[model samples]
Target: MITGGSSGIGLSVAHDVARRGASVTLVARNVSRLEKAQQEVELTMSKLSMDGKVQFFSSDISGSVKNISEMVKNAEASLGPVYMLINCAGFARAQKFEDLSPDLMKQMLDINFTGPMVLTQEVVRGMKVQQEGGVVVFVSSQAGLLGLYGFSAYSASKAAIVRAAEALHMELKPHNISVTVCYPPDTDTPGFVEENQTKPIETKLISEAAGLFKPEEVAKKLVDDSLCGAWSSTVGLEGFMLTTLCAGMGPITDAASFMAQVFLSGLFRSVSAFYLWSFTRIVEREHKKRLENKKSE
Candidate 1:
């Protein structure tokens, strides 16, 4: 079962899963979108093979844990117990600290991290009961590994998943259920575009320097990693750069990781300064304009 399976990485995973000859159960909001996605997945699967089925439950899995349980039960009844679970249902939003509220932060956590973890719990319980163990993948982000400015909420949510997956991977090993947390760089998806909207100028400047990924490339690596029963994976070369960046360079390699960190942070600081300086200039100009208007009056 794939959550947020209607689009982006989730949708891409759906196609990959079906092509691998697994019947898919897609969970997401928007009935029409799911239906459309289901059709596309099936069509692609058919081109790849003669036998594959696609199904979907069109409701918000982010609403509650109970809904997730019920939906999984319904899906099991139709698909004969899911053999895999991909926690890909997440969204991104960004804004300055002054503009975002507590509720919005919670919503970010609930959907991006909480929703996936809670929903996974429901699915894994079934796998445990049946003892028919399978694979589970958490689609985390590089942002989860390193703190990026303007991503306090998003980063926290992702960091939680990375830690959770590492812990769970150890716990679930005895059950023969493989757990993998995958981190990918910015992919060319609507979600990425949406996130760019609220991206702080600092983050945006860094993002502009990033190498954009096509969703298919990310999906391919993910499917391969899941099949290989990996405990953790970084989905691309860009991801590897992030891994190195996070690992921190040492004296043997003479790697200036501290410098790297500073370099990255400087990019953001510069943009932040730009915005602040611009705002200051605008206000000063406005004040001058007002004083001149008063003199004219």
Candidate 2:
């Protein structure tokens, strides 16, 4: 089951996973978009010559927990037990911290953090009942790893998921269930386009350094990592470095990654300081430019 499966990374993952012969149930708020996504996934499955059922459920994930639980129950009734739950339905509203409204902050928290947590709770209960462990994937952002200009609310919401995933990993490990949280850099998606409209110049400049990724590329890496039971899935070198540097209290089951984290954490921290300094300079320069323009006017 994939939330936010109607578009962006979620839809892309639906295609990839369906092609690999896994039935998928896409959950989203827009009925029309979900229908289109279901058609797309089915078409792709046919092209790949893989027989997998593709279904969709339209529900506002930020709604009541009972509603979300019912949605999952219906999905399981149709598709059998959910072996994987992907929490991908989220959005970002980037703006200066001072300019953000309390409502916007609450909405961001509800959609990005609470929605996923609620859905995960429902799915995990089912997994426990069946006594068949499953994989849970959270599509967190690079903003979650590091705070940036114009992303105060977004970063806070996403950062919560990373910590929550860590706690879930430890608690569910005994049940044979594993959790994977992906830290994807900015990707080319409808959400990214919308986010860019509100992004400050400094935020854009700082974010561009990480480069943009395609939804398909991000989805492939995310699905593969989740299937492999990786604790964290990072898109590129920058993301990998951030994950290693921010390896706070998560479960690091891979010996190679653990050794690398131990050896390179300090080095990465030094490099990250330089990056942060550059970002700070950009913010200062942009502010100065704006002030100068205001004075000239």
Candidate 3:
């Protein structure tokens, strides 16, 4: 089962997984997008399986109890056993500390952390009872590990995922269930590009400084890493360092902590600048190539 499987990294992961003879059950919010994604998956999986059956279930993740439960049941019925769960349905919202609101924070948490956690519980029940046990993957971000200029809510939500994944991994170990948490650097998704156009000046500058990742490449590596069930899989250098620094956020505070925050923030800004510049250029080139292709067609 793959949540957020309608677009971006989730779709890519779904496409890859269905090829390895895994019957993919895709979950997302938009019915049309899910249909399109399922088609793409079916088209790709055809080369690998002559009888692969893929299913799609659409639901918004903002706490839909009955609908979500039904979707899972239907999906399990359509496919076979639910042995693996890849949680990729998530997004980052850019907001300064000043603009942050309680509602917005909850919104971020509900989708990025709470939804995945709930879905994991549901799947774990099935896997546990069936005695087949399973693996769980959460598509977290480097934002969770490191603080960015204007990602307070986003980072907090993602950070929660890391902690949640770790705890869940430990608990599920007794049931032979492996939980894999992933952190990918800035990737060349339409979401990233759209964000760059309107994010804070500081965020834009910081993001520009940090290097960017390709969605396809990141997607491939992320799914592979998840299947391998490593403790943690960070896709880039910046993400790795941030993960290390975030380890001691609770213990560090006061004047010394303030200084450390300043230093770390500066370091983050510096590193992100290079990433932003390189990735923005890549997107620009790709955008132009796409325009040319459309004109020719």
Best model per lDDT: 2
In the range 96-152, model 2's lDDT, one tens digit per residue, is: 999999999999999999999999999999999985789999999999998999999
Cα RMSD of all models vs. native, in order, equals 6.8, 0.8, 9.6
Residue 8's C-alpha lDDT in candidate 1? Answer: 90
What is residue 100's positional error in candidate 1, in angstroms? Answer: 1.5
How far residue 130's Cα lies from its native spot in candidate 3, in Å, is: 1.2
Work out the TM-score per prediction: 0.81, 0.98, 0.80
lDDT value, candidate 1, whole model: 0.77
Model 3 TM-score, all chains together? 0.80
Residue pair clashes in candidate 1 = none
Instruction: Please report the TM-score between candidate 1 and the true structure.
Output: 0.81
Residue 229 of model 1, lDDT score: 80
Candidates 1 and 2: which is better by lDDT?
2
Per-residue lDDT tens digits for candidate 3, residues 96-149, read 788878888888899998888888777888888976568888888887876676
Counted clashes in each candidate structure: 0, 0, 12
* Regions of candidate 1 where Cα sits further than 4 Å from its true position: 244-297
Candidate 2's C-alpha runs over 4 A off are: none
Query: TM-score of the candidate numbered 2?
Result: 0.98
| Residue 260 local lDDT, model 1 | 49
Ten-residue region with minimum lDDT total, candidate 2 = 248-257
